[model samples]
Target: MFGLKESEIATLITAVSVEGGGDLDRVSIENRFARATWSGLAEPGDRLAGRAIQQLGAARALSAVVEHWNTERFAAELSADGDPVAGDDMRQAIDRWMPRLKSDTALIALRQAARFGARLLIPDDELWPERLNDLDWHAPSALWVRGTDAALAGIVDGIALVGARAATGYGEHITMEASAGLVDRGYTIVSGAAYGIDGMAHRAALASHGLTVAFLAGGVDRFYPSGHDSLLTRIVENGAVISELPCGSPPTKWRFLQRNRLIAAASLATIVLEAGWRSGSLNTAGHAAALGRPLGAVPGPVTSAASAGCHRLIRDYDAVCVTNPDQMAELAPLVEREIDVSEIDSELRISSATPGSEVSAENVDTVGARSPETTRLIDALSARSARTADDIAARSGLAITAVRAHLGLLELDGRVTETGRGWKRVAVAKPETSRVFRSPSTDSE
Candidate 1:
């Protein structure tokens, strides 16, 4: 649309438009265009784009989004020939190259984006959200947007609701009621499209006839967690599903974590309905707080494991405590909003190197490098003090023998010195090499 015959050039424009100004920096523009281009062609624009991206990194690419791209900047930096051969010659050379992809593949992406009930929204477009600029290098190239464009028209009124995929019944119920209530109050709901809470929220919003948006961790063309394909189809017709990645990218764990930040940043407020101490939803909450968005958590029953994270946030992090939709909707803004934290003291305070940081199952020694089952057993025991093998097995969903084997390893590692009574996880000063063996979960805690 911007006079560049190459689709990558057009996509580059979409990426650049997210920023506020219209200036184009040929170098940076070329870099972003190269990343978008992704073809085998050896065009000059592609070569230049690659060099810029290599020099700037994804972070810089994100910055260029909101920054003006200046053609004059290109003119000032040209080589001595005055012909601008290095720069101008490259631009001319790119014109000689064919558009990178097969027409069929390109058409498919466009058609799928449309059929998915999504419109390709570029940065310069009227409907683009200015707040997305907050993401910096993390910002999207272009958003495949669905649902009513009118829903996005009102910027000040959207809310993001997110939580676990393995949601408990209580979590799903809370999501449904809160999403419905939020919609009733004229607030658009935003979430991912995973099972459990995310799916529940989107479905509830649809049921209530409220506007909702789903942000995916992959391409707009290929929906990950394929079970949600039909569910997503409904959303495209009734709400929106968006992605910052190019069309057809697969959803990886890293992408999923990255996607949460968008959910938090896109809305005025973010409410974490239910999460475990380790649920990925907390990543969204962290993003919300960092961005200075209003953050709230539902008060779950104290005994419920799913609510443990929520309780921790309200008690420790000072997240606004919400009971129902009304409380969530009317959360009083704290002048100095403290972060809500569900991080458990036991989880945080325990040390892998400490002498007591060990558990003794019947056969397994689980102190150091082992399977996930072993890790799960250790975490369960450490979090709750001493427990029988059966209890540990039930909580961790591991075979009894596997749990026992991990316990044996922990004892041998000396990371978990055994007690006649049972085993416990503790911390101790350790050698530098030993530090590498520590669990990441322990470090985060």
Candidate 2:
């Protein structure tokens, strides 16, 4: 049960940390290492892992499990922390995690990832995709990503294009068009990197020179469906290939199902180009529906079994019937708008309007009237990059403690958002912007 010293653990975490090998403070290093350890110890979408980490902090929760804490101690600790779980649940969770609680294995994964230049992203990293949080307790403990910063950030505009692995000619054709068209319109293509429709989608996106992200069921170190090795490699070079599992892990049926949830959640929308009644792509669609994201289905020949799933979704699941890429793009909100201070309606008020003016409000609730500290925090935030609270504090001249507190307030008001281990400013509506709203049912001119 003995573990690495704090300093040694910090070194390993910093090696794979998405902050790109910068010195991290004691608290952050411990937390990131703990999350990476948890990712290996628990299966993807383990609610107890998330809940325990939420209540006890990753480092503390990991320690409790490593020490073989009794059920009573576990329940008591969680209860005192304000979230009480039954002893039976704690006992089961501890049992489920203990078998895989190999600290050495986590160390190996970290080293392997460092060798491959893979990044370990905890919830606090700026590269972490925030939409995954929608999965709540089932969200991944950490993410293993192999790609550039821009490729990862492109997730904000992602739209999932999923379908049957045994895709038909018609299905591949639809996927190609949808993928390329969406790319042309500034969408990032997302998929599981499987054959048929998923492959076609990625290929089309790449052909159009657009960003694409693949969510793997296994480690980013090992590409699944070995035949697609070249395709995934290109993705790593030009887009991103991501996973929740550690470096040496292999793909399994359950992991694939869990991986589908990520493809659904990370994307702004999910479109099923082709599927059979029991197709795995349906799993992705179900996750999309559960998340309340826009779901689109491409229609095909009535006689084709591959199109049955799409029909089922349209008839039974209320999925919008989308025939073309333009229709599919209509599934999500166009973009995150940025507004000029002068564009604030009279009620919102800029008593004195000026172009590109920054307003200062003492009240945190007031949108443009940022407090001195909040103004400094926002000024420190970049629309294109995410910064950890530590970095934000250093840049904004606030203490790390204060930076975190203000971030919570700012996040609640839609002023800033969490990405992996950092934060980014959310773009408000820009001034003098003209938008033509189009209904999904409307025909393209």
Candidate 3:
């Protein structure tokens, strides 16, 4: 159907499905091939395409698009089947998807990806991160993965560490410590494979003999940030380098922003090591917070401009001020069971024996250790005037339920008080404390 012989199509499907460890029937093969076509045909996070595929199966959706049905006809077909897309939205989607429609593009992409030893991972695949399904319509149609299946499995328990590409020496050092510590505690590290903090995180995890996955904005075949070529190569050897795009696709600004969603969704938590006021890492943090995943940020010197983004996250976004591996580890749920008794004892010895192994709770409370929702509620509150829950919801962009929950936490923290009118931010002195450092090395950084 895509200008390839039936035998060739079967071979391609087999290659992609082999790693998934599934027996594919003829129907399954065609569906898998259709999804590959959709991957190349649509941009990442294309809601129109996602909706169509969800309503009609991938194979049927591709047929509907390829048949050149007019907007009115397509809309009527969808509406008859109880789909919500119609009129201008349908026409716009058809117009956008038409130009990329090619009979042989999917076949070519599949062959190219296979040549580079990449596997096509669909939602049904065993190694697929089920967590990504949480993204709903924004989830990828298919993933181009390069590396061990075992490495891909690590993603379910992974934590994303990301920050500014132009990170300072301080940022690199903290990321190094955090990455290594997490690795020692048996958690996989995930990052964007960008320069600076991202690069250091991967390198440290690798040095610690830990599995680390790198999510790329472009195709898995071509690593972005050309300077990280060797590093990415090593990652593919021990960890996986993955992308939602097909081979030969290039990274763009929009894709980078969209890519952050995958890193956040795939991991159990996301940590910002260092960032400026407008660092792209904040976008990652936003996605994590919105997804209800735990988010963390490392505190930098109050004077260092590089740490401003991290500080902003703590002050405004309710990010936990994670200073050491232990604090960072706390962000992940079910992590306590993952640690070995021996490892816990070893960590305690190191924390007690080492001069600066632990950062006190007071040190970590510079921005207040409330949940992100609490921080948002506090930000929405007025110091002098009481505001109702509905008023707080409108201002904080939180749902009424979330606002109430956060208000309860804030009230318990003594940071807010309820009045006849509503709630008011309580004026209180934040205690003074020293910055927490994990060790002498981190202190120097």
Q: What's the lDDT for all of these models?
A: 0.57, 0.77, 0.76
lDDT per residue, candidate 1, 1-445, as tens digits?
Answer: 1223545554434443333225655554544343433322221113343333344453353233224334344333333325343545434323222232233433445445545444555554677766775665345545655556666564335678887677888889889999998888777888888877888998999899988888886666676557888888887777667776555444544455557777877876788898766566766777776655667888888887777767766665557777788876664222212233223122222122434322112111213344544545555465225556554443343445565777788778764545655666666654443221222221111
Show pairs that collide, candidate 3.
none
Q: TM-score-based ranking, best first? A: 2, 3, 1
* Model 3 lDDT, full chain set: 0.76
Per-residue lDDT over 1-445 for candidate 3, one digit per residue giving the tens place of the 0 to 100 score: 5445767877887886635525777788888888888887877787767777776778888888888888887777667656556588777677556656777778888888878888888887788898888888788888989988778988877989999887899999999999999999889999999988999999999999999999997788878777899999999999999999888766654566678889989987789999876677777877776666777889999998789978987776557788999888877744442563223322212122334332221222323344544544665677788889877764443556667877897789788999999999897654422121000111111
Off by over 4 Å in 1: 1-118, 154-156, 332-445
Candidate 2 has a TM-score of: 0.75
Q: Model 1, residue 128: what's the lDDT?
A: 72
Tens-digit lDDT string for candidate 2 (30-81): 7888888888887777777888888888989999888888999888987885
Candidate 2: list runs displaced more than 4 Å. 81-83, 336-445
For model 1 the TM-score comes to: 0.56
Instruction: In angstroms, give how far residue 286 of model 3 lies from its true place.
Output: 1.2
